[model samples]
Target: MTTSRTYEDLVKEAVDASVDGWDFSWFEGRATEERPPWGYARSMAERLAVASAALDVQTGGGEVLASAPSLPPLTAATEGWPPNVAKATALLHPRGAVVVASPEDASLPFAEGAFDLVTSRHPVRTYWPEIARVLRPGGTYFSQQVGPASAVEVVEYFLGPQPPEVRDARDPERARARAEEAGLEVTGLQEARLRMEFHDIGAVVHFLRKVIWMVPDFTVDRYEPQLRSLHARIESEGPFVAYSTRFLIEARKPGR
Candidate 1:
């Protein structure tokens, strides 16, 4: 007869697993998330094909950039976390990309107008001035960013309701304004709300571990009561439901 694992067993498994890179393969069957319709990777790849020099900021493990079918002559990626920096270096070096270890919130290290194109996927925080500084005149900045109130359902489930300010932290309009302030014109902007489901408590644990910004200081011991309650809910319900908000933004520096 088959045996079902206990909630503790599942949570422990997730906690012990390595979340080294940006890879989410471990959640294959345990969780599901709907992707945006624009196909960000494909769009970025198309832009990459035509650019002569490009930079990918906050590149976690270089997974997205490395996946491009072709890279520009001079391609570089910046990573904040050390583990991810090493991981990205390993993954991108062979592909003719340089991985720079940069501070999470520090100014970018490149010289002024160094790249013809700049891209980022879900950057922790957008540095509009820095982006403009690093891009040549007429250069484009393309990115898919986390929108306001993204995955708040899961967040509130663990931490209770949050203030409006916290909920609207990543507003797309604010991003547009910032880009404009930095002398870049916003050419395209689109937002989407996608579905997310967690089939088991372990999936939740893994997600929290990987995406540290979700809970900030999430811990199994500290939130055991809430975790247990959520475990019971998942046991009864088919799956826990949440929504992920994403926004695609394209900005350009003036002058051809």
Candidate 2:
């Protein structure tokens, strides 16, 4: 990587860039992250091929669901963000899937036991009970979630060291417990820690901007000092490295 580019140029480009939808195409050359081995999209598509009715929760731009080569006869997806709702609708409607405008925290808009398959990818938050409620007996719920301490390297660099509870808020075990409590049987669960790299400060900026929850109040003005220092470090050190944790979980509703 070259260090000749000024920090001002990189950060401004990222800051002004659009972060709409779930697409991360803008970071093609600026950053990179190792993908999990489970091949979440392929796996979800395989299950979708066999399902009779399916619903995708927190379907950000319907990207993952839209990637499926086949969908059940009755397919639908829910997204809370208006921009994402529009994006998802535009993508999924042509494929015979209805996109619903629903908040992540609100109850699912469908009737009970309406879907035989439920899927989500990197949801802001998983509503276990709601998922179970919408799933039919013997239905399956599959999701790829951000695991505990995901991308904490960047969090710590931007802010500071976080408490144990805050860092472990998204633990897989907690998710397992919640699913069990919701009357679902855990079928499979796996976790992975993958390498992440930022070639420049702009990638970091664009990342934080896209994934707002990572740093709730991330603004270049507020973190300019830290950004400048990190940018310098990257210029000298080649690229900044971080590890992001992810988990794949599958659970089933028990019944005949």
Candidate 3:
């Protein structure tokens, strides 16, 4: 006799099937790679070590924790993440890292004055306020984010055949204002633009879907019509360049 499966089991199977079909990299070989390094991981770890007491906000994939396991003990939390991610993170940080499944815009699980250094990369915009709220006075907050420039290929592939209005590091004033509003004094900012190469447009599309974390609102399904037009355009225009903009900004909370 066959046993009946629960609704949860069916949903889990569906989700797992989708994930398995996608050729996504879990970065299992992170420990072996030599060149380029994980810049965001190493850099954020360094800044946190400087602050003494630190928190890694939304520690997805645990790469940052893996990068700096020897640094000062760190508290790790990932807003609205699954237990699997938390479990993986624990492998790198056994003692202090704890996962929180709450949305990043809402109140965090940790108490006030919980940390002196807060490091985040590629977190949703709503999480910034919560990040500001959790750091100790006179603390440092460092975030390396994939800026609007990251959507270049997607915009070109889809989005009505025209480029989206994306401003680069030239918009320093706006960047400073944003950090200040988060209750942090802006210190330094840098934008590193890199051209990601793809063998063909199909490869570009695959990378966008799997590795890039394209905004949920602008998924491949939503942009399929435009993507077809984009594919045609690329066939006519030849190889294309995907521009990725990496922004590194450091800020400090005011001391009493």
How far residue 185's Cα lies from its native spot in candidate 2, in Å, is: 0.2
Q: Over the stretch 1-256, how does candidate 1's per-residue lDDT look in tens digits?
A: 1117788899999999999888999999899999999999999999999999999999998999999999999999999899999999999999999999999799999999999999999999999999999999999999999999999999999888999999999999999999999999999999999999999899999999999989998999989998888888888877899999999999999988
TM of each candidate vs. truth: 0.98, 0.98, 0.69
User: Is 1 or 2 the stronger prediction by lDDT?
Assistant: 1
Question: What's the ranking of the predictions by TM-score, best on top?
Answer: 2, 1, 3
User: Higher-lDDT candidate among 1 and 3?
Assistant: 1
TM-score of 2: 0.98
lDDT of 3 by residue, 158-221 (tens): 5434433443432445666877888879887876666554433344444544443453355445
TM accuracy, model 3: 0.69
Candidate 2 C-alpha error for residue 149, in Å: 0.4
lDDT of 3: 0.57
> Which residue pairs does candidate 2 place in steric collision?
none
Model 1 error, position 32 (Å): 0.5
What is the per-residue lDDT of model 2 for residues 1-256, given as tens digits with 9 covering 90 to 100?
6666799999899989988788889999889999999999999999999999999999989888999999999999999999999999999999999999999999999999999999999988888999999999999999999999999999998879999998999999999999999999999999999999999999999999999998999999999999999998898888899999999999999996
